[model samples]
Target: MTKVINIQPVTRIEGHARIAIHLDDDGNVNDAFLHIMSLRGFEKFIEGRPAEEVPRIVNRICGICPWMHHLSSNKAVDGCFGVTPTPTGHKLRELCQTMAHINDKILHFFSLQLPISFSGRIVILRFGMSLESLKRRLNLQPRL
Candidate 1:
């Protein structure tokens, strides 16, 4: 007989996902795979689109990475239009990119990194053990 195991809607990711483990007759896991069942085909749909439409189209690819998509698509638009972004536009774009980095870093620290680092029943204890060592590394903490 076959055995099937499922981890439904794994909670930690930015979006929904499913994990599957298939077991053979001896009940050992013979196969494991992860699937993101939802469709966000922005990357696929971007192909063959008009060059001018890239900035508007790709910007919606990921709500979390819109700044990156915007930056990339803006470059594509500039290339297609045979024009360069003005100095002011470049400066503004740089500021947005910097802000995006800050947001992503916060997300990593609070939601992903910190949780894993503090795992187990005595999470506070684990964190306490490393806190002093971590505090000493000026480079590890983000500069406000």
Candidate 2:
């Protein structure tokens, strides 16, 4: 006989996923596959837009990583322009991206992990304060 363990709707990731662990005849875990259920066609959508529009267009791919997408698209557009950003622009972009990642990490850690770590109403306040402060500092304009 075979057994399977499925974990659906995995939390705290960029998107939804279903993880299935296959079991051997004795029911021990043997294999696993992570299925991404939130796949989108952003590539196709951006294919024909003007190079200048690429950044804004691709930024809509996901609310979780719009900064990454925007940065990537900006790089691609810069390549098309046959010019690279100046050292100052590069530094500013890096700073903004770093801030975005820090904000995202804090949100994930607080909302997902802190609840299990601290069981109290204060956790909610902490999460809210952290998120709000990060949002203000990063100027994270939502794309979704």
**lDDT for each candidate structure:** 0.73, 0.77
What TM-score would every model get versus the actual structure? Answer: 0.62, 0.73
Candidate number of the best lDDT: 2
Clashes of 1: 0
- What is the TM-score of candidate 2? 0.73
Q: Lowest summed lDDT over 10 consecutive residues: which window, candidate 2?
A: 116-125
* lDDT tens digits by residue: candidate 1, 89-120: 89998999999999887776655566444442
Clashes per candidate (backbone, < 3 Å): 0, 0
**Model 2 C-alpha lDDT per residue in residues 1-144, reported as the tens digit of each score:** 668888898865667899999999987889999999977888677777889988988887777778998998899899899998999999999998999899888776776565534442224435346766644434534333
Extract clashing residue pairs from model 1. Answer: none
Model 2 residue 69 lDDT score = 87
lDDT of 1: 0.73
